[model samples]
Target: MKREHIETMISQEVERIISGTDLELVDVEYVREKNWYLRVFIDKEGGVDLEDCQAVSEKLSKVLDEKDPIQENYLLEVSSPGLDRILKKDKDFVRYAGRTVDIHFFQPYNGKKDLVADLVGKGEDGKLTVRVDGNEEILDMKTISQVRLHIDF
Candidate 1:
């Protein structure tokens, strides 16, 4: 099966699993490094804990083992997306609007490679709008490398 298809299946299964619970599926990743890995990122209102990860892992592992979705021998990992989670979906862009984020570009934009800005939201024209230094900046999605939530310590 294709990667996107597999991800969609996983998302659906996870939604069924977490239904009626506070846990939210942040993202599902199927990738290969030295070995194939299926990582499920989950989060809750107050953040996820080790117990939450373990429970989801056990249930999903059982289902994956029974269904045997992927042909390859892979390790399954379930965890929180973390504080610096990347904004991957449109819902994320909307959900995180007005929050501080770190925007990185493939090349310098306005003489800077990256800058901290308040996420205004993703534009319908395949661009992202962010507020920097009190002014709104519309960034071409083609030039953006990454946009993740930025937390100050």
Candidate 2:
């Protein structure tokens, strides 16, 4: 089956499995590096522990075994997105607003290709507004190569 279809099917199953739980489904990715991998990213307000990952993995494994969604053998991984997780959706932007983030760009913007700033919010034109050096700047989301949470150690 196509990877997208596989992801969709698994996503639906995950949603069903996590229905009554505090776990929130973040993303489902089916990819092949040296071997195929079915990775499920889950999250909640505080965080998820190893028990959470193991439980989801076991339950999803059972469903996948019964359905046989993917043709090839793959490793199934269930885990949290972590402290510096990438922000991929509009909801992510909204959720993480007021947090510090590292924004990457394909080319230079304001003479720099990357920036570390506070995420203000999503702008009217679908751009991301951020505060840099106390100045608010609106950036086109298209130019953003990546946006990840930034924490100072």
Candidate 3:
């Protein structure tokens, strides 16, 4: 199976596995960095703990093993997305609305391609409504490179 298809299949299986639970599947990625790796990122109301990771990891590992989808040996890792979680899905944008985020753009907008701003949810036109310097700014979603939750310490 192709990488994208494999990832999609894994995501579907994970959604089923974590259905009816507080655990929300954040993202699933299969990458090669020295070795093949299948990472499952999950989150919940109070954040995920090691126990949560273990449970998901064990369940997913068993299912994948039984299904025998991948031809290569890969490490299966299940964990939280962490404080600086990247927003990839719509639920993330909605869930993290009003939170501060670090945005990186593919091209500079207003002479800036990187900055911290408050996420105001995605607009209907696929643009992002953000509050920067107490003013609202609409960013073209296509120009965005990455949006991650900003951590203030």
Name the top TM-score candidate.
3
For each candidate, give its TM-score against the true structure: 0.87, 0.89, 0.93
Can you give the lDDT of residue 81 in candidate 2?
93
Scored by lDDT, model 1 comes in at 0.91
Lowest summed lDDT across 10 adjacent residues in model 3 is found at 121-130
State the lDDT of candidate 2 residue by residue for 82-103, as single tens digits: 9999898788989999999999
Q: Write the residue-wise lDDT of candidate 1 on 59-115 in tens digits.
A: 998888899889888888999999999888888899999999998899998899988
Score each candidate by Cα lDDT.
Answer: 0.91, 0.92, 0.93
User: TM-score ranking from best to worst?
Assistant: 3, 2, 1
Clashing pairs in model 2?
Answer: none
Backbone clashes (count) for model 1: 0
lDDT of 3 by residue, 42-79 (tens): 99999999999999899888898899999999999899
Candidate ranking under lDDT, highest first, comes to 3, 2, 1
Candidate 1: the clashing residue pairs are none
Model 1 residue 8 distance off true place after TM-score fit, in angstroms = 1.8
